[model samples]
Target chain A: GAGVSQSPSNKVTEKGKDVELRCDPISGHTALYWYRQRLGQGLEFLIYFQGNSAPDKSGLPSDRFSAERTGESVSTLTIQRTQQEDSAVYLCASSLTGAAANNQPQHFGDGTRLSIL
Target chain B: LAKTTQPISMDSYEGQEVNITCSHNNIATNDYITWYQQFPSQGPRFIIQGYKTKVTNEVASLFIPADRKSSTLSLPRVSLSDTAVYYCLVGVGLNDYKLSFGAGTTVTVRA
Candidate 1:
């Protein structure tokens, strides 16, 4: 795709249910990132992936949240036993390079709005 | 990661030059200042970035002092369409560092 894309623009699931959000980064982009934005709040970093190397999972809020990326393309963010506090917009972004470089601008996706009932 | 502080909101009229400033008291030496604009229900878009002094692009201008403790994003002749949330980020130039977006400065451009 020409830009980063996310699936299921909106999802509403009951509390305690599991959910999965997907992201398709721009072709050739080696770095991918995930973030969460609560209502009327700034974006919160979740995780990052640089190619096939070990991902930076330091930002995941808890053990219930996990993510995976295949090669350098599609990625999925999975939340087990979702809680109401987990409701937010899940945003995905991709950059041409990894964290070492300072000039690559990250292209973002529209994000998936997740609602926990 | 360096933390940034910016205004929560600002009001402006059309054709006015809006300048939003961000303060990063503990900014790192290698960190660069970048600004992004995000509209309602949409993802943020990169506007401008700078290391030191001043840098201007087609969208906006980034002004950083020699101390690099703070930076400002200047939007010239802002239109109604420019109304959005502007975030000031400090990081090592777009790698995978955790981007801590403080409550962005919401600029409301009225006609």
Candidate 2:
């Protein structure tokens, strides 16, 4: 894709249900990231992937929040047993490589607005 | 992660220059300052970054002082389309790309 792409721009799910958000990073970009933004709040880092290295999941809020990246292209963020508090916009970004990659700036997607009722 | 503090909101007018300042008292020596802009319903886009002194790009300019405890983002000739949330962040500039965004300064550019 020309830029980062996210699937299901919006998602409404019931409590206790599961949801998956997908992201397709720009071609040739070796770094990918996921973030969560609550209403009127700043973005919270969730995870990051650099090439074939193990993903850095230190920012995942809880056990219910998990993510996986396939190779260096597509990634998925899954939320288990959705709760009302989980409603927010999930954003995805990709850069040429992880930080200090010649000051490579991250490009973000439109994001998926997930709502749990 | 270095903790950053910025205004909750700001108001500006078209054709005027807007400057948003951020303070990071505990920033590490190896950290670099970066800024991002985000419109409603869209993801953040990187604007400018700098280590010290001044760095300017076509979209924005970043000014950092000698102390490195604070930095400023300057937007010249603002337009309504420039209305968006601006975020300032400090990172190690190392291989780790994890970002922790504080409550951004929402800039409302009116016509």
DockQ list for all candidates: 0.54, 0.50
Badly placed stretches (over 4 Å) of model 2 are A99-102
Best by lDDT: 1
User: Candidate 2: deviation at residue B24, Å?
Assistant: 2.9
lDDT of 2 by residue, A1-117 (tens): 598999989999999999999999999998888999898777788888887454588888899998888877899999999999999999999888776564677788999999999
Q: What would the DockQ be for model 1?
A: 0.54
In order, what lDDT does every prediction score? 0.88, 0.87
For model 1, the superposed segments whose C-alpha errors exceed 4 Å read B93-96
Stretch of 10 with least lDDT, candidate 1 chain A: A50-59
- Candidate 2 similarity to native, TM-score: 0.87
User: lDDT tens digits, residues B18-80, model 2?
Assistant: 999999999887787889888888888878888899999899888899999999999999999
lDDT of the structure predicted as candidate 2:
0.87
Q: Which ten residues in a row have the lowest lDDT in candidate 1 chain B?
A: B92-101
DockQ of 2: 0.50
How well does each candidate reproduce the native contacts, as fnat?
0.66, 0.62
Instruction: Give the DockQ-based CAPRI class for model 2.
Output: medium
Model 1 lDDT tens row, A44-94: 989999995546888899999999999779999999999999999999988
Q: Over the stretch B22-106, how does candidate 1's per-residue lDDT look in tens digits?
A: 9999987778778888988888887887889999999999999899999999999999999999998887464436676777999
